[model samples]
Target: MHWRVPLSWLAVLCLARLQPSQAELGGAMCHKLGLRGECEVQQDCMCLCFHVTADNSTLVDAAYFGELGYELILFTPLVHFYHSRGILRSTVGPAGSAPFYRFSPHHREVDVQRHYCLGPYSNPSPHMYRREWNFDAWIPPNLHEQYKGQGQAILGDGKPLMIVHNKYNQEWGAAPTNFISISTLIALFSMLKDRYRIVYIRPDPRQNLPGFGADHNHAEDFDDHEHLRKHHPKVLLFQDILQQQRNGTRPDLNYNELQLMLHADSERFVSVLGGNSVIASYFAGVNIIYAVKGSELTGHGLKDREFDLVYPRLGPNGKGTILTVSTTQHLLQAAANEFLQQQGDTEAGRTVLEASHRTHKPHRS
Candidate 1:
């Protein structure tokens, strides 16, 4: 007969994959999530697409489009001035992850992946906080459903809207993604309740409560319901984590769901962000994060390249103002003063800035 392995041994084997040696975790963290993949620099490639701006305006090609195409080695008979496929993505804009490669199936022979945008584009990373291009096939299948049924939209009703998200995954850091303290968020949202409307992007749908897998069979072990409802009054609660399991309906934003006007109407967004927020706020045209005092580029899961790629205008924690950074309060106030000041909502923002600058003197790293 055959012998069966103990459950304990199985558990150990499963956990081993997560604990890639210090060398693996220490090196180049993938920009995708900074939790997996060993690639440090993020595989870089270039493509020429028929680009369209967010307002349906066509954008002029950067420098020499034909030269760039030839450099990319595309032997094409019809290289149009307007990249019809368009500038597909950026760290800051509706286009989503600018670096995540994509290829048009119809033009599979053309190896270069396609990219574009649907709105006012933020510059890619260091250039600006967001970028814009045009869309080819970026539309989601659930467009109508999300438009009709997507849970909530934290819009600005004469208030500065701020979206904050914190993810928890067992693969990050020494333990799972635990460094993002919910209490810290509560404190943050509480501080600006009067001036800002706070929205909390839930723990990623892919994530599960402690001790529970994707199946969430042991969701009972998690008991943060009262804590969330009671203490998190200042912040908007989208849904209850512990409740989704008991109801059998997984309450979280689906990939398709994000495309339907998710942040299109937002004023500002703040988070200990990742690819998801970067793209969503790109859609909204606003993504800002509070650089926690003394933390390098926000925290453990962030890569400097990713930070630079999305927001070069702001620096990590307190390194300098633009290149090298300053305080989130100082930097953000400047951005708010400049970017949204013309939008006719400056007085309140300035007040928040002054308050934040005085109280949250982001310690220079």
Candidate 2:
């Protein structure tokens, strides 16, 4: 019986030895430093990029790259890693001992055909890009809920709203670029939050507005002159008339309930335009009078006609308030700079403008 027990123990020991340990399996899958034998045996291993910053040594985490199924290709002392998936591609190279990888996270592999440049310049204009528009159409429901929580008033009469003129739809809907324009729009909205009540104009279900059109001309014709006279007597006649007529009735009610009512009711009174002439004329009135740039009109490719009238010279710190006064490209550059300055990086504003002029392909006026 004792010999049989010893034989049973020996069999259990043999089975335990045959099965791999958890540490052994994990080690085979992931690279661990100082495990030369295991690393040399594996078909693929992790490469560590180290750097010294402020007298402290730091290691670049290559685990993210490894999980994406990339093999580190060594070229002498320098290493390069690349991955390709359909039309998207990415490459990671030694960036001063801290390896930096360019990745298109949507696809598993890199796209060799499409080369991407850095900065806001390499980005597409909001009016020129197409696929981006589709993506912009979808906003996470949670974000909408959050916006509502913040008292974001939509549709004055409690009607369901459709986005007629959102900065996201204006810039990203037509362009294949990062969210620089949209970011600027957010910053501007932030700045105006205390002074104005901003609302996105929802499309009327009965009214089908075209996705893209020329300019709007008769925007002012839609203003509620009666309402304006009663509440906002100081409101300009032309301004009240124009907002009533624009297709995407996204109007800023500058913290005045009377002005809001005048514009809100005016939206119900006017017929919307879809052509370039209409848009250009509408913008000519708005931009010329108030020095305010509407994202909706601007996204339709209208520069600030008010530039010559409002911003005759540079404002404080060589800053020009009329950034959206020129071509779409120049407007984008200026907007980007303005955004950076708002973020407390004043130097980045000029850098972005210079980079835009040098790198971005100019849009023909």
Candidate 3:
């Protein structure tokens, strides 16, 4: 018996042959969308491709894919951190990779999981801030063990350490917001200085990594360093530690590597928004993040909330408690409540900081 092929079936086969491969189709789609690179989707996973600046990127994005059990082929800047991680199948970038800001994948890449910059589409939660995104795979606790105690000799001073991170960048708006002010630092230091060995961290833009290029922050000059040096003599400055390490015979560690080492020793952190807060959330501790405005409060582009949802997952098994505040008053209050009230209460002849619990500051635009 001879089987006859239908004309419709033949037409379908011809159409399938004529259609571009998924990678080529993705490349064409990316070009049409004005993206520099392309995206390729395979069975149950996708190869997210982009060569954008690292500042516009987030390790959270990479982890999101990892949690979803996707194999990643990242071709972005600052690929050193992504190496050896189980999630990334492969990565292509220089250790000294300098990111040019002309191309941003937020608008271009559409096939991958995106929770940010999703406005202009018909999604219910345009920014997707209403829901939580997992960051468990971003920096596992095991990975942190390697860097732990490396900064202990440098930062250990017999007292429990608290890492304080501050960034002065105009990311959200033209004026400087989402930063811990010098006056606030003075108040915070005076409150907890004697009880805890406070380590202040603010990366200098001028200090470039040995192999990796200097991470850009569009920093505005502030005199907090001078203030800390003059007033708080015992408070360890991260820059000073870097300078000391650089002068001494030690391994050439980049800013992120040094941060990982120092932060591993710390269980508590006080940080401003942006990458500073993200990195601080890695350790299993209470990360008090201060942000006056951003996607955390107002959502990425739409409206819901991002901080309370995804911030905790940055730590191991979502163990970290991320206390987010907007005002300096609330920041002071959280510090007093978490650190002073709990730890420094019984310290003999220690000055107590009174942070009012009555006036709760809500997130603002």
TM-score of 1: 0.39
Candidate 3 residue-wise lDDT, 307-326, digit = tens:
65555655655456788887
The per-model lDDT (C-alpha) reads: 0.33, 0.25, 0.53
The lDDT-based order of candidates, best leading, equals: 3, 1, 2
> Where is model 1 more than 4 Å wrong at Cα?
1-83, 86-161, 170-173, 176-180, 204-226, 240-260, 290-365
- Which regions of candidate 2 are displaced past 4 Å? 1-322, 346-351, 358-365
Candidate 3 lDDT for residue 94: 23
- C-alpha TM-scores of all predictions: 0.39, 0.20, 0.65
Could you say which candidate leads in lDDT?
3
Return the TM-score for candidate 2, rounded to 2 decimals. Answer: 0.20
Error of 2 at 249 (Å): 21
Candidate 2, 1-365: lDDT as tens digits:
01112334323322232224533543554334322111111123222222223333222212222211011111111111111212112222211111122232221212111111111110121122222221111111111111232222323443221111211112223431211233343443333223233333322212223221111111211223344355444323433332453424444222122222333222111111111111112111111111122432353343432232222121212122222222334444544443345546555456656645744432211
Local error of candidate 2 at residue 175 (angstroms): 18
At residue 41, candidate 3 shows an lDDT of 26
Superposed by TM-score, candidate 1 places the C-alpha of residue 78 at a distance from the truth, in angstroms, of 19
Best by TM-score: 3
